[model samples]
Target: MIKKITIVAGISVVLLATACKTKDLKMNAAQKETVSNKKEVVYQVFTRLFGNKNTSNKPWGTFEENGVGKFNDFTDTALQEIKDLGVTYIWYTGVPHHALIRDYTAIGISNDDPDVVKGRAGSPYAVKDYYNVNPDLAVNPANRLQEFEALIARTHQAGLKVIIDIVPNHIARKYEGKNNPKNVTDFGANDDVTVEYKRDNNFYYIPNKHFEVPDTEKALNGEENPLIDGKFEEYPAKWTGNGSRLAKPDRNDWYETVKVNYGIRPDGSKDFPELPAGFDTKSYKEHFDFWKGKDVPDSWKKFKDIALYWTDKGVDGFRYDMAEMVPYEFWSYMNSAIKVKNPNAFLLAEVYNPNEYRNYIRLGKMDYLYDKVETYDKLKDVIRGKSLPDGLSDIQNGMADIEHHMLHFLDNHDEQRLASPEFAGTPEKGKPLMVVSTTISTSPTMIYFGQEVGEAGNENAGFGTHSRTSIFDYVGVPNHQRWMNGGKFDGGQLSQSEKDLRDFYKRLLNFSLKSAALMGKYQEIQTVNRHETQGYDSGIYAFLRWSDTEKLLVVTNFSWLTTSNFEIKIPSYIMQKWNLKDGNYTLTDQLYHKSAIQLQVLNGVGKAHITIAPSESFIYQL
Candidate 1:
């Protein structure tokens, strides 16, 4: 019989027959104050592709033909231009050395087989070496670490913090840590190969089972490669990254990577020591102290060291990939260590499970998590005309307790481009959506590199298809290259429409960055207006944000080709909160500053007569 593990509400996780438990955590006043400060804007750029100027986008192209961007390309001039976009932090994605098809055998780096690697440039998530930088991103392969360090120094000089990816759930199929510290060793190096599960084992082995690559005839998709031999050498196959226990994982599985064992046996019972009750309410320093002399899993210590190693190297933050896959206890151990090193390190996580949000944030010590499943997905549906904007209220109200810990973004590497035919079909459609997303809360905002200028991402770059930028293949982002303008870092080649779109982003981002009301109190006025006003509907959304001195009334029209002219009514409850009297006030559109309207307050109820253009958004201040 298969044993099932159940997590009890408001208590702890029942690990089958074990006495382990995970306690819930609440956000303290200090953490709340930290999030309520200035709205930090994070600009996520694919580091290897950000400064690449080549436009020859050949399918399945080699690194020589489709030249890669070097670390030196992020010059002071280029970084300053990015900083001028109101970006407080720059997430340089794909910095760690991962498995790729390129040859570095001359420098003692083994060539990765093309059969296991995703594309000419391997997936950034399948990291091979956590200690070193990607050789392909350096002008000289041997000096990759120095090049990255120089880039880090340059980034700091330009007045911006740096963030990089730390994928802890799994690692590349073939692990090679050539530049690891002498004290640290490779994962699974000291493990016993014959056992299925052990408390100290780094990996769960299959005993006598030998590994076999997936049996997919279209593995290469007709691309000719000399290394496509349909075989890899593994004595006893370990589990796949996606938790496949079979000796051969399916083609769709994360076959290029292997899962790391964190003292969780094959039967779902934890072998390591669990946290004591009420650890969730403790500070990171307390959490770090709790693990001082306790015996923990090998993988936990290894990942913690890796994080501290980078933190010591001057990295300001980390973006943990697929954080939910790892145990909650491990994050408490890992993130607490990071905090002890740098108290202000920006620790962002990718957690999709809504039930575990509090667990990761309060218990795991994560600073921010991706608000994709709630805010981003719902907004995308509204933008695509698949749903009404009425449901957005439910999402915001539901996350009221942890709203500030959620990070909002309209575009990222994993999602389809806003301008692509598969998405909104035009860059202009994102304007209203972006306004609602960025101003709706106290959460930080993130934007992909090409999102500002409308990169459609419609290219067939080998292993990747249209509608999303290729992270696996060696390809130049065409629309992004136009903004690059041959390393000038100016939008010299952008069309008039593209230029206008970028200008819109610059204006909105800067405004959000400086606005104090955005990080203050929020109340939804859309529901009240839809019932009391004549023309307000589900297609239009309205809200109010207020601080002690500043008051803002935000409205957005989600309908395309349909203009909205209505008397937006603000409830008496909000009017009392803003402490407004029964009098006339001038309401000016903060964006574009094109028009000012009359806001008449009568009987403690404020009413604004406004006209919102199709797909237009307004941030009106009193």
Candidate 2:
């Protein structure tokens, strides 16, 4: 009988039974669970593909000119293109109504912002309405449901799930409804205010009668009239009632967003003259309820449903923008709603350094956050020949942490593209490194739209649309172009370098998909002298990842100029299982397909000595 043990809290408990039946049974159950939760691969795309640009295909700049808005056009071609890539999930960024009535300084055109513009109306992030889709996106208004159903069907047909972007932090400032600046109502009385509001315990409002100030001055400065003796005062500062000076909090300089009053005065002061007792706090909900339909309570509900609407339309998951800034309660509600809609829906939050904020995992919330510290900062240093402080031990610990949770990517829309030489090294040298780092990391990988093609630009330090490279340009301008090239117009073909990178990524992605060791849950297997070879003092890095069925040893020679020979002993379990002699094994180069086993005696001990090339990596499978 096989011995069985129950492992809980990372501890194995042996039930002191003479029989091993229970232990074997529990181990089998654990293995089954592990196999069932294998990680999946996701591909991201910007949805401008389904729309057209007026400048390139003039006269038909609107949806009418391009037959792409219909489901047949996208499903027939676009779906097939993505499906061929062998990705399991697709994340579509922003397909909602981003129309705004701002004057276009570029073309001097003044109208409700058209969906088609030459750098006129930028990205879908500038959403004007949460309840509707951009007219250009859905050509026949009546066919919205039909288009969604078809898109979903095609995506399912292609064997991929879909995810959409959900922005809940703020709405476009151009909205002119009941929530607009003009419709000044009782402050904090109705929850349906158009502007974003907060409900912390520190907010207070001045009465109109408390002070006197010019309208222009009042407009420039966000000050309201004061209330004196329950009457509006001409000047707020001159109010003679038992009131305190209104204070605003000092805003942080790093963030570009306006801060909402967390129910507090800016100056950290509390309400001085209290309002009448028994004031209904339920009135707070009214501000958020603005523009909400009969069944919906607020714009967030509509926004949440819009996310589901896209998932229902054939998108698999969401990459939630500014997920941390949104109220946790809202995320909880959204996750629950999504679970009911689709249990398999994958949610990836754009949170930076989640290890610092573990609260994001509190039940039924964001499933994945960008693992910035370990993947980007630490791992990048190791790859780029920088000495690690904790050395190889840190790499092992980092991989262990990554294995416990869902981690997304190193490069995203908000940051500089990974293809940039600064991050990846010049394309020639960096492409190989990028492949090594991304594939070897413990988490499932994510590559931005143009990352596969060596696209480069820094959007982080104020680089705009004009500065960034376009993937559409590389693939040759599809008849339906959604990108703006040089001269502020669309239709630019891809350069030769872009094509090379795209092909390289195609190979890397396919290889990753085919590897069971990459997709399956990983266990860290011990290698002899693990502390010495993977020393905290030495810059050398090595680790082993094993599935329940197979094992792979990864070793990276971190030095850029020095070629060193390191002796390693294979673990007894691994050596015995692989039918090796004297507990010794040789390293092999997976990239070059070469065997690297050479036996030698070091310090009177038999060890497998292998020479490493400068800045090289090796993988041996047993």
Q: What does the lDDT read for residue 517 in candidate 1?
A: 73
Candidate 1 RMSD to the correct structure: 8.5
Backbone clashes for every candidate come to: 0, 41
Q: Rate the local accuracy (lDDT) of all candidates.
A: 0.82, 0.42
| Position 112, candidate 2: lDDT | 39
Worst 10 residues of 1 by lDDT: 9-18
Which 10-residue window of candidate 2 scores lowest in summed lDDT? 8-17
Give candidate 2 misplaced runs (Cα > 4 Å).
Answer: 1-36, 49-78, 99-119, 135-150, 175-304, 353-357, 382-404, 431-442, 458-504, 519-540, 557-622
Residue 500, candidate 1: Cα error in Å is 0.9
TM-score for predicted model 2 compared with the true structure: 0.61
lDDT of 1 by residue, 1-622 (tens): 2222211101000000111122112347535423436799999999888878878888888787877888998999889989998889999999999999888999889988777788779999999999999999999989999999999999999999999999999999898988789888899988988898887777778889988898664544656667778888887998889889889999888889998899988889988878898877788888889889989988898999899999999999999999999988999899888888888899999999999998998788889999999999987777676777777889988998788899999889899987887877788877777888888888899999999999989888888868999898888988778988988888999999888888888888888898877776677877778888998755677776666657777777776665667887888876776677899887666766766688888999988777766555555555
